[model samples]
Target: MPAVDWRVTRLSRRRSTVTRAQVETVTGRALGLFGLVFGAQTVPIALVQADALLPGAGAALMAVLYGAIVGLAVATVTKVAVRTACLAFALLYALALVAWPFLVDDPAALHGAAPWLYYLCTVATTAAVVAVLPVWAAAYTIVVPAVYGVIRLLPSGGDAGPLLAVLDALYAVVLGVVVLVIVTMLRQTAGAVDAAQEAALERYDVAARLHANEIERVKVDALVHDSVLTTLLSAAAASTPEQQQLAARMARDAVQRLDEAGATGPRALDRVGLPVLVRRLRAALTTFTTPFTVRVVNAGGVELPVEAVEALYAAAVQAMVNSLQHADEPGLSTRRELRIRGVRAGGCVIEIADNGRGFAMDRVPAERLGLRVSIEERMANAGGMAHIESRIGHGTTVTVAWPQGAGGAA
Candidate 1:
């Protein structure tokens, strides 16, 4: 490829990549906001209950410490830094709960016989952290929760104390399992949301590009019609033979320019399904032209590239629009026939053929510019071909062969 072409392709690819990345970044930010909401609720509850959970410290002090840690962990979610911070805090929590019972001579009475709640709390806290933590934090969460629950069940007081502790420890283990299940469900939901958002953004980008392309083509069409065609017409009216010949040449160039304009835009391609799109076009065609029969032979489940689909739809719509606009009769308008089919031999191929009031393909007059932009140019760029079989008074057969996998999905 030439340097200019290569450069253009590279730039286009880079822009697409950047757009997808922006979508992902937006999703990440939304997830972060959600985490903050959860943290705001959970942290306060943990702090208020800390005095009961950790008897040695003042409730305010414990709450503040735990709140600070939770806040720090939330902040680090933008990076993976929060995982280590959370794990370290969990370890500290384990040490404090373990040492609490041994701090006083009458530790059993101070802890109210059963300290199983402390172990369970630790396990739940660790499980919550694991949801937001890095992938590697799994080991610490699984092991620590299991170990603490088991250790907390050991004999401490008489039969009553021991039995209560064992039940509490069992409850904590169950709590940890519940947290793990919730976390997994939330992760799957988040992933599905991300995928849907990505797909939506991709569709939007394709639509914007197609619109911009159409505007550019229209501008080119207007320029040729307003300035160049007018000049050519004026020149052709001059008496001089040389002026007439030159004017004729200029007129031909203008016709070519008009045709070139259509080459700018891609075909219309609807990604969800082609039949759904075709049905819409058929309905729109009904509004303008009657006695127009649309025969869709086959449109199997064939996925096409975005660009190819866009091209196919554009060509088909243009053909139908032309039939509605130009092919009317004085009293009895001609009957138009449209045939659309899809094939997936190598890749998808959508062929749309319309038989309506046709024009003479051989003698395209100096004024006829619609075919230039709508038929010939657009199909060429889409890596497709357009064939028009038309005769005056009879109908025109416009066949558009769309090559799939060339254009991006529209």
Candidate 2:
């Protein structure tokens, strides 16, 4: 059968279905757009308040402010350096507010309904929601507005009434807090969804494996009854030379059939070049369901167990299946790597590793033959050793080495 060519193959990026990741991404973009709204109002406000500023110092500030706004706008779509852009915009806004008294040419000339910086507090506070922790977000919402409220009482701030100044400060804090609460709550809910989905997937994997085992068991039982038992009964009933000869031929044919059904025997095959094994292994990797970042290093010079390459390939496939089923860690992006290398002295090593939630060897149930018979035993039976190493939070690495403990990795 031909391997299915999935739309999302090895070359395609891993598209995460995890809700928490999606929520964070969409929220970041939303904040960017919100920043643009406040950013648009900045130009007119700056123009109206220009006469109140010191021409030289204020012109430089205006240039920096414009650059920061442009950065904030770009961060909306690209999502690259989003945190950096948000911090840059917020810091610039605070700096401008702090220097407002010195920047002004005269106190009365600064008269306006609201200071130029007031329009941008929404942008800064919203930006804080995405890039900062809850405590820092709270500080940004309160401290930035409080600074403006203090300035609102001074002549340089246009000397607004006490009631209006307090209200404006209160308004900024309320808006910031509301945004913070919404995002935080949504993130928590999404995280719970992700955990539940992973648990369901794990259960599905277990059920699928059990169903496959039952199918294999039925096949083996049929093979024994239809082939081996029939050959034995014929041999026992034989009395004449012709009948005996016929039984001998039937027995030989039945043994060949049993061999095809995976009966192990000491069979020697001519050693082939390492490149041959690599070509075979690489082709096998392409047929796997999960995409792995494959790296072929020093896959030349050495040759391994010739026909036994199939054993290595089978082990590799099993490892890939294990990674696909359970390597996704909550709140962390997953990455898988397949490394194939030819070492000194007719030896090779194949490693399948994942940066995901790992497991302790002692903790895994004994009945899970995936690690025992499929990977470890298969490799060992083929004159290779399979080493599995993992930590709870770190990750997992399965290494298949030929000529067990015999040669240095290339």
Candidate 3:
């Protein structure tokens, strides 16, 4: 035999709960119908049997009123409301059933000589009790019939022996026990089904999150291979003195990349002022071969988390490096600009623009990770975003922004 799939079992249990609830609702309505039919039959019988209609008339009216209320509540109310109404009705009906014999003008009328209508009322009320409160209904079922047996044994009972009374009581008790067991089992089954559904939903959520993290890790690995490793290989193959100097700068860039990777731990990236970060980037740019200008506006006091700062810094540096390597003119002067500004709505914006030859963004090679990984993905991982605009003729512009109150990715 195949091993049981717990997930499938849990899903099946969940579905079964709805079916059980529907069945219980139908059963409650059926009991209501029984009450309505019993009341309709007994009311006229009660009126005809009693000669005077004052206290006796009140009992007949009460039977109709109780039955109507129970029927209406069960038919129209929600599941919870139906249960509440049934419980209330069961308690009141039990009390009335126990007192019914004593309320009559003739105590002998309740003995073996009692009308069929009287016995019918007892059976209907007992059934309603059994339908709603299973445990309490069992006690009521036993108590009600035992009370009738004792009443029949009295001197006023007339012609009723102990054997006949015992038989009548036993019938009611047996029927009640059967109804009680069924209702109890249904309730327990519904509860177990509900619990299984909740467990299944929790497991599904955990699985979905694990799948997403795996996809993200794959993307990060591809990014590292394309950018850092490619730069190291190119730097090792340089021939000219100027090429060697450029390769030394690339080696320093590679070391910075390694430092950023090692600083991925939360403790290493402490919150720092935006102005301090801008000043540091300005100092780093002085070593570059290309002429560059750094500009800061209204960004002196803005604070960002360490991880966000590292991500923004790395993305800005990559954009500058790309401009130096790719954007060049034979005779015309070319310069790159780095602009940092604090947004009034919160967070900060960093823009890197070049007045040099720009390439088509869509035509960039898939293996090239300068814009994809080092700039865009890095910013996204920091809970920020990078936007790049470029045309073959017009210069390239890269804008990186971190939104207000963003916590960098873990």
For each of the candidates, give the backbone clash count: 15, 0, 0
* Candidate 2 TM-score, true structure as reference: 0.57
TM-score of each: 0.39, 0.57, 0.45
Error of 2 at 162 (Å): 1.5
Task: Flag clash pairs in model 3.
Answer: none
Q: Could you give the candidate ranking by lDDT, starting with the highest?
A: 2, 3, 1
Give per-residue lDDT, candidate 2, residue 251.
Answer: 85
Q: Between 1 and 2, whose TM-score is larger?
A: 2
Per-residue accuracy of model 3 over 1-410 as CA lDDT, tens digit each: 22224543453344223334444666676666666676667666556545422365556646655564555455433333455466556555556545555555554444445433334534444455534556566677677667666655653333368887677667766776666666667766754664454354445435534554565556456546865676677677878888888878777776776666555522221244565457557756988976677666666447665566677888998999998888887786776899887765247788899877888888999899999999988888787889888877678898888862322311
Local lDDT at 58 for model 2: 57
Compare candidates 1 and 3 on lDDT and give the better one: 3
Candidate No. with top lDDT: 2
Runs in model 2 lying further than 4 Å from the true structure: 1-18, 232-410
TM-score of 3: 0.45
Q: Which residue pairs does candidate 2 place in steric collision?
A: none
> Which window of ten consecutive residues has the lowest lDDT sum in model 2?
2-11
Model 3 misplaced regions, further than 4 Å = 1-24, 50-56, 59-72, 75-77, 107-134, 152-159, 219-410
Choose the strongest candidate by TM-score: 2
